[model samples]
Target: MKQLQAELHMAMLMITHDLGIVANMADEVVVMYHGRVMEAGSLDDIFRDPRHPYLRALMRAVPRFNMAPGERLTPIREARASTEHLISGAARPHVAHAHDGPLLTVRGLTKRFTTRRTSWFGAKPGGEVLAVDDVSLEVRRGECLGLVGESGCGKTTTAKMIMRAMRPDAGEIVFNEQGVPRDVLALEGDDLFAYRRKVQFVFQDPFSSLNPRMTAYDIISEPLVIHRIGDADERFARVKELMGLVGLDIRFLRRYPHSFSGGQRQRIGIARALALSPELLLCDEPVSALDVSVQAQVLNLLLDLQDALSLTYILISHNLAVVNYLADRIAVMCAGRIVEVASYDELFRNPVHPYTRALFAAVPDPDLDRKLDFAALMEGKASNPAAWPQPFCLDGSVKLPLLDVGDGHLVRASADADVSELRA
Candidate 1:
């Protein structure tokens, strides 16, 4: 779309949650919140020096690769209702990890799909698509593991397999409960129900994920009701407790999803996910549908919840900034395979994969001194395995493996490539 606009010399009005897209494609920016324009200026002015309180919070909420250690995200608190006491008391339930092992491990995961072509006459068989290909990773206890990629890169498919929403064609998914390893794919009947209770999902779209017919109270308490955990009174109390945790007002319990703002609706979703008291949370672009100011609030709330509940998260997103803000480690996926996996800091400091480098290069830096290099972008060609340099390129004949590049960082390169050559 960007290429088409550029080639046609067309002026496009783009609406997106991705600041990187703004930096790359937009000349002017208008930041909005609560149906009001918070700030408006040229791209440089908006990103480099935001003046509005909401705008500033939004800027801070976005994760930058060059950020220093111990930096914290500052979410907008002016619009939020007071619930400090509720938050403080909500930190009671803590799940202990066995030693320091990963809470979840996914190995050799693969999924395939066959597309059929439809014509005026009839439907014809089409080629097979590799949605996910032999992907493996681990989610450490109480830490966020971010899965990042461009669209159609299988990030969401991988998350679905982990949630067991869809069965994988091949692979093993293990959830380590304390010390015992449970095969997620092999479970059935009551065990699967129990697993669902231990792991919950937060969808990306707030409006569609929620049912407009259901009140906030019913929406949140539905999970509890399904599980048959508590009686009517007890479920109502739990719903109220959840509302407080997500910073929603108790009075809004009677209101429908349509009555609330996008951020509030997301909070309600989080509250619903928490109803089961899951140890692991799979957030599929939870904040992508929200406004900039609201995005900060939601991100901050997720952080707080993770800290308080000792929750482990598998956050799937295309936004590098969002993932960098929350993830302890990151995995870069391309062509339905993981090309790079590294610590949050390591990946940014030194990205080995060509695709990974292209992703970082595309991100618009807020600093005035550092501007995006349009020529360096290569018009998105870096994503193609065929376009990569010698050792990194993967053809059908050559076998490539994820090689350890020291300090626990790994990069997928040709097995024949020497460590020195791979480093280069």
Candidate 2:
């Protein structure tokens, strides 16, 4: 971090599967799995007061601090009942916290794609796969809302909708500012262009997101040029300033994307996003592909930028620890739906969803004293959406009708069945 020569007192925004790193780095935490949030809290709260069933499983999965050499760590279990409509309630009292208000809301958003026919198969048509299904969510001003899920759970799809990179078939995207809600998806022409300026996207791959041919200066200044925000001199000045804001040296501006390292590339991507001075930033797995050290640097930069700019961000990722540290609130997403939503501290203390529990159980423990790997115990447990067993939830049993169990904690309605039943 010192070698990068970043700015002052950098605040971290970490994302990782490793819990030990989380314990050491995160000020707060959010636990998630299978696109659903299982828990979140301060590092101590998650370690000390794990009220959610899933959380307990995660704790046990951590190799025992004192155990026989050959003994295996126990994997977390799921409920026997179907997850179609189960609702798990909070075990602790609810507490309300301050939020900056909804800056963006996605309502009834849905998208689908039909696979193109193959010539060898006589142009056989492929069925439609629903990527996003009537999903609704809101990000408060100056707030980080974490969107979590397993791979292919539509986390990236949802982020793309926010970026207008992919159009939703059915939904209303409302951008609320100063108590006024404007339908973002319905706008066109200059209105749409203006809306694009208001919302910017930061992709997961820094290597591919940038134009290889363009220098960092051109890449960052492109948005300014397209939007006609500043003249040549001012745009150049802004580019240099943004590079510095993201902890990059001014000398980097003349270099192409390939000239930098993974971490440096991401910083340039961030600088471009800031060029438009967007109000809402849609971050799609921004740190997933980087090294542990690099991840920390990028995460820290994000936190510093948020504080400095008071920006609203919708952060999408599979890593729970990252969300736990940075997000004020969280929503766990499943196949095309938001299965649970809650404040960071409250949810971590008491997770209400079964999938959420399973996800938490999947996290690897680096500091565990035991030699057993809990992930192996969890194999054949995650749900497979296609060819699922009767009353199956792609992993195990889980009913629908995800219920809001009060205090803003939402979970699958079938929260009664215990671990034994979940495995049966």
Which has the greatest TM-score? 1
Q: What tens digits encode model 1's per-residue C-alpha lDDT throughout 54-73? A: 76766676666666776766
Worst 10 contiguous positions by lDDT, candidate 1 = 78-87
lDDT (10s digit) by residue, model 2, range 8-76: 567667777655556545668888778898888887788667777865665554432233433333434
Off by over 4 Å in 2: 1-101, 119-121, 369-378, 385-399, 414-424
Candidate 2 RMSD to the correct structure:
15.7
What TM-score does structure 1 among the candidates reach?
Answer: 0.89
Give the per-residue Cα lDDT of candidate 1 at 161: 93
Q: Which ten residues in a row have the lowest lDDT in candidate 2?
A: 85-94
Indicate which candidate wins on lDDT: 1
RMSD of each: 3.1, 15.7
lDDT values for all models:
0.84, 0.70
